[model samples]
Target: MGGTVVRQEILGGVAVLTLSNPPVNALGHGLRAAIDSALEAALANDSVRAVVLAAEGKVFVGGADISEFGTPPRAPLLPDVLDRLDGAGKPVVAAIYGAALGGGLELALACHARVVGPKAKLGLPEVKLGLIPGAGGTQRLPRLVGPESAFAMMLSGEPVDAKKAVAMGLADALETGDLVEAARTHALKLAEGGAPVRVRDRGERLDPATRAGFETKATEAVKKAPGQPNVAALADVVRAGFDLPFEEAVKTERTRFLALVDDPRSKALRYAFFAERETARVPGLSKETPRREIASAAVIGAGTMGGGIALCFANAGIPVTVIETEQEALDRGLARMRATYASSVKRGSLSEAAMEERLGRITGAVGLDNAAQADIVVEAAFEEMGIKETIFSALSRIAKPGAILATNTSYLDIDRIADATDRPGDVLGLHFFSPANVMRLVEVVRAARTAPDALATGNDLARRLGKLPVTVGVCFGFVGNRMLARRSAAGERLLLAGALPHEVDAAVTEFGFRMGPFAMSDLAGLDIGWRTRKATGGKAPVADALCEAGRLGQKTGKGFYLYPEGARTGSRDPEVEALIERTSAEHGITRRSFSPDEIVARLMLPMVNEGARILEEGIAARPGDIDTIWLNGYNWPAWRGGPMHWADSLGLAAVAADLDRFAEESGDETLRPAPLLARLAQEGKRFSDWGGR
Candidate 1:
């Protein structure tokens, strides 16, 4: 006899309670209620000597149903259910397979003993959601594993495999055979002995000297994630486990956990999590839409971006052919690919054998004829439309039928490039950021004539490459780069308006960006922009002058900042500051000091205004799509959500007012509030609240 989500069976006095929730066996209200009744029945039956807990799925229990978050609490909360398991008079053994995460791992910890399959992984990853474990995990984990180990695991939110779990004393043993049989045998032995030992009764494993310095040590461990209160709060909860009684410690953890769940940071992280998953979903695209298989790929160029793109395909277990115009270029590209994997091997991130396997998947060619056999050909040749057109035109003639021709253009017209080929429906853009293998964002640019299957293929390919693809319409710079153009413009203007490169960078860094626009420009080489500006007859006197003097960023040791010999970090150069002042005088513009707040407002408001314009222009599908691009691709700070989400948080009226103020002060029409922004502000609405596509 069984309930809806849990079933019970008796074998030789051992009652096996199997959670039968499909998929991941998420602990929802029904599952919790079923578990409670099952446990009660096992305890009430005098013939039942022990209870073996297991779940019927690939995962023992993934975690709590995330869909239930932020809703009203139901009866028999997770904490209450865990309390029953922890206090059960009969011995309880957990059979963990696949992943036991968050509340699932907490449930296992509440049991008397844990037997894990060889491939099982256990973790308390609540910190990733800006939460700490609420169901006595903080109290019990430290007692099972030492405070330092628990602190590291919870803070990092990474899982430990069965072997690592056993080594850390989190799991009793690992089972190589059938997990259910192993767990039943273990439970039978414990039944004959006595009541199973409870984790709450275990003493702290850390020495007195280590315990004395735990606060400082744990604080230092999480120093990299600054401004995250959950990190500090998690440390406090873990430390409480060492000093406070188990029940009191659990209450304290629950209090902190609930508080963090309500925090803005947590809310933003949760929004980001959902937004990332939503990016895979296309509104008009049907789930029944057929996708073309990308069995083999060919890359046209052999430069940095091309090599990285090749690596993405090769790492995904697809055979890739890299084509360069010359053998020397092909050799150089292959060497760089090997060197990159070699570095990963040295860093212990990739095994030597795995690197060799990926390298073996990538072959080289010297011409376009070699690409005829490829199912997909990515033109990473150059940003020039002429070069892309020539490549695609050749691919159209020589490539296999039904081959998807993709251009890796950053800021070019994909429709125009597609026009060069006969099969416009087969042509699209796969704009990857620098170091394609590492970056998670890919803009799947859909040309006006793109076929539905081709668009679906682009989305599917990104997923296979372990990338987040945001399908966008053809436009300059697409979504992320289009908004970034406005930010770059503001940063450059700030340099002429009395803010030094480092000062602008400092304000941006303080605002939670990894690097300032000027610092990024310096690292990416000022010459690339200089060359583009020269072609377009554009002028940034300070930057052009820096390039003219051969200060091509860290490559030549100087640009907006100076890099000492062999040093990656740059220092502010007084000469660069003088150059900026001279450029201001030459341009007949008055230089004025900008406060950090003013600088941030000026830079960020323009980006938000551009985002509104992009939304109005229909280049991006939704505000969340733009946010997804920036969050995953541009390092827009996940804690802030994205620029659009952040703008909504600031209130559209406030952002509109800032845009108007900047436009009036600077006389730059681009700073004027976008129509959507102005209307939304006037109507008392938010970008997030906007439901339009």
Candidate 2:
């Protein structure tokens, strides 16, 4: 006989309530109602002296169903259900396995006792969604594990394992074998002994000094993230717990949580959460699409990019061979890799043994012959087409059949590169961002003739390397850099028109970017872009002047800004300002002061326009894919939900009007509103509302 989502059974007078919702068993309305009903039944049954709450899935309730957020209220809300579970007349034990996160952890906290398997993880991660724990997590967690521990866990949104959970008193015990049975026994023992223990009744007090220390740390964390409303809200909610009564603190947390749930930052963060997951679902690729096993990998070139790419493989426990053209270059690459690991170890981010193990997985050689054993070969050579073609041609001859060949090209023609190889079907782009080991994004560029399995393999490899992979069609700069070029172009014009480097950067940073374009240029070195511009015969007069004057950024202690010796931060440079003014006069540009708002509009609108073009041109499969690339790769603020979503939130009509204004002001046709953007604006539509072409 079929049963409700929550099934109750009597085992030695202990009522075992098993949450039977499929998949993640999220606590939605129906499941919440079922759980309440089961609890009521267990409470009334004379034979049931205690209760054991278990879940019939790999995870013991993966928290609230995110889809249910912002929807109409349902009876027996999560907090109420948790209260009912906590206040049950009989003792209750939570048998936690897999993950107990957010509402899941709150549910466990509500129980009299929590028994977790060794592999289980517990955390309250609502802060990541721009909301605090609404259902008493802020108040109760501090009661279990003091404010300091609770503050760090909630702020970072990272889960603690069963051992840590027990150590912190989040879980009463670690039952590695048969969690449900052990939990039932524990509950029965509790029932036989006395009345149930209540988490709410445990009033753990914190010393004034310890409370002040936690408050200071939380304040600093909030200060570090300037414009993120959730950070400040989290700090406020956590601090409130210290001063307010238990029930009063919970009420405050609930009020703050609900307010944040309706907040723009929260909405954006939630959108980004879903958008990231949506990016993985390629339109045409079926679940059955064959993905090749990548047991061994090879990376060509031993430059910075190549070394970082090699580290990605090694970190994933995949053996990698790095091929360089010369023995000297090979040694230099190995040295760079070792230095990076040593630095990480010194920072306490990595253990010496772990670093050594990762280092051991990597081997360096001087030729393509070493690539024969690799299941996947990633060419991280120079961006020149000739060099890439030569490497691909050599790889085609050397690599084993069925081996997936990938290029770590940022902005190059993948089809042309594939044409150089014999197995065009096996060729695709695995465009890892600079410092590949650190950056989470990897643009999986799908070439014209690339096979489905090749694309699948690239996606699989990216996941293994802990990278967010966004599949895109071949194009100049693909999705991210293509749109970035538009933003950079606008920033350059802003520099010449009147704004100095600091002004432009300040405007963008104030708008929620980590760094301004010019400031970032200084750190990356202006010579890099200057070289690319020179090769393409591109003109950015101020940038060219800076390069010509031997002010090539931090390396030279000057570029758009000046830096002192041994200092990373740059200061305003009058020489750069003079050069910009002179360049503006030479170009017959009338200089005018730009407000921060104007600067942001001019810089960002062009990117939105370019993104519209990218979507219309089929370069990106969906608007969300474009957003994903910007969020992960380009440092787009998560709370803004990426440029496309941000534009949608701003209203497409207003964005289109801004684009038109920018085009007219700058006399740059490239800033003209794309036809798709204009149409959507006219129709009162949005990029997020696009149903996909």
Best by lDDT: 2
Residue 588, candidate 1: alpha-carbon lDDT: 83
The root-mean-square deviation over C-alpha atoms between each candidate and the true structure, in angstroms, is: 2.8, 1.8
lDDT of 2 by residue, 1-693 (tens): 115798888998888889888898888888888888888888999988899999887899888888888899888888888888888879999999889889988988999999999889899888778778889888788778888888999999999999999998888899978888999999988888788878877765455666877888898998887767788887887788767777788888888888888999888887887788888898679789999989999999999999999999999999999999899999999999999999999999999999999999999999899999899999998878899999999999999999999999888899999999989999999999988999999999999999999898899889999999999999988999889888888888888888889998999898899999998999999988887777677888888888998988899888888898848889987777888899999889899999999999889988999999999988998888998899899898888989999899889999988888877877778777899999999999999777767
Residues 69-181, model 1: lDDT tens digits? 78999989999999899889989999998899999999999999999998899998888787889898888888888787788888889999999999999999999999988
Model 1: residue 97 alpha-carbon error in angstroms: 4.9
TM-score of each: 0.92, 0.97
**Which regions of candidate 1 fall more than 4 Å away from where they truly are?**
8-11, 20-24, 56-59, 67-75, 97-99, 116-121, 145-152, 156-182, 204-221
Model 1, backbone clash pairs (residues 3+ apart or across chains), number: 0
* Top model number, TM-score: 2
Q: Global lDDT of each model?
A: 0.88, 0.89
